[model samples]
Target: MQSSCRKTIAELGPPKHPVVSARSAGRTRDRSPSPMRGYLIPSPLPTRRTRTFSATVRASEGPIYKGVCKCFCRSKGHGFISPADGGPDIFVHISDIEGEYVPVAGDEVTYKVCTIPPKNEKLQAVEVVITHLAPGTKHETWSGHVISS
Candidate 1:
């Protein structure tokens, strides 16, 4: 299992050339035009990758909550939580979410999100994968594990 810090660094490659700051009181004069650099260094920006996942919809239950226009907000630190009919929050990747059909708030939409878990680490909601459209009905009910008091 890779730590978050390690993963971040690995994703972001090492810097290319060392940057030198100009001295304050250095008298400099240039007559000839500066030569164009031969090779261009690659950017260090991290590559954007989309992952897919599935979860149910719930308000303030788990982490993610559906927002206006198919967009979802993360709960705590996890990614977006997709809503389903009476089920766990469906995790979906932000990339997998289609921008064409904007999902309205409270609309049951399907999407895909990323999921990463380390061995021995407790599983947590990371992203949401909108799969199927939940049936439209007022006052929906769900069943959960019964806990004996």
Candidate 2:
């Protein structure tokens, strides 16, 4: 029985690329369906696409909350916010940040929270706006210029 199964597998060879219906794949009706409809060719380049945001993030219907910038790395494109209500620090993404200057530690900020996708166990700050800069500290703008606060 095992030999027969192995023989059948060997006869089939390696599996082919994933198949999808022409209509679902967005093929126009002008193209005639031949040889079991049009083939959905996979991209030649390796796929490393990452989803930076989701539909939930775009909703932005949550109440605003105040926080302090615990630490932010412009190069790394992420940081944490210390909630004013004394809650645990929440993750902050660079894309979600608003205003001109990049956030620094102790900078007072206002933001809304959004739960991360997949597991949805962790929270991240969205629509972050710096209300006040940390006194006597230097801040950098998105344009690569530095300014003292």
Candidate 3:
């Protein structure tokens, strides 16, 4: 019976339409005539080359400004800092952060400023150091262990 079933299944060929990956699928969701045809979708996350270039151009020797962590998404690899001087929140990349622990909301941090590329009108935080962890909140280390501070 098993041999007959195997012989019957062997007659069938491969699938007609092959699976198309998100990268290979150039059409938009609507599938309308798009000007971006054949162009690869840009990732929201920053690439390693971008991090290296920005780091080399912006040194860590500048005056450090005190700030509190507004919000940080470790998975997203970016965050915003509320400056102690009371201005717009500055963008901080994961590569810019120092220390073993990942930053959480309300954590006290000191960081240097760097102009965002292309326009240079916006500022971002670089060389970030977490001075104080937020009380009563759980903190996670880069090694994936959780600690209460």
Clashes of each: 30, 0, 0
TM-score-better candidate, 1 vs 3: 3
Question: Clashing residue pairs, candidate 3?
Answer: none
lDDT (10s digit) by residue, model 1, range 91-147: 333333443322223444433222333231222232232333333522211222222
> Against the true structure, what is each candidate's TM-score?
0.26, 0.62, 0.65
Compare candidates 2 and 3 on lDDT and give the better one: 3
Off by over 4 Å in 3: 1-58
Question: By the TM-score metric, which is better: model 1 or model 2?
Answer: 2
RMSD of 1: 18.2
Better of 1 and 2 by lDDT: 2
Order the candidates by lDDT, highest first — what do you get?
Answer: 3, 2, 1
lDDT of 3: 0.73
Looking at model 3, which ten-residue stretch has the lowest summed lDDT?
A: 34-43
- Residue-level lDDT tens digits of model 3 in 36-77: 222221223333347556455555556879999988878657
Model 3 steric clash total: 0
Q: Pick the candidate with the highest lDDT.
A: 3
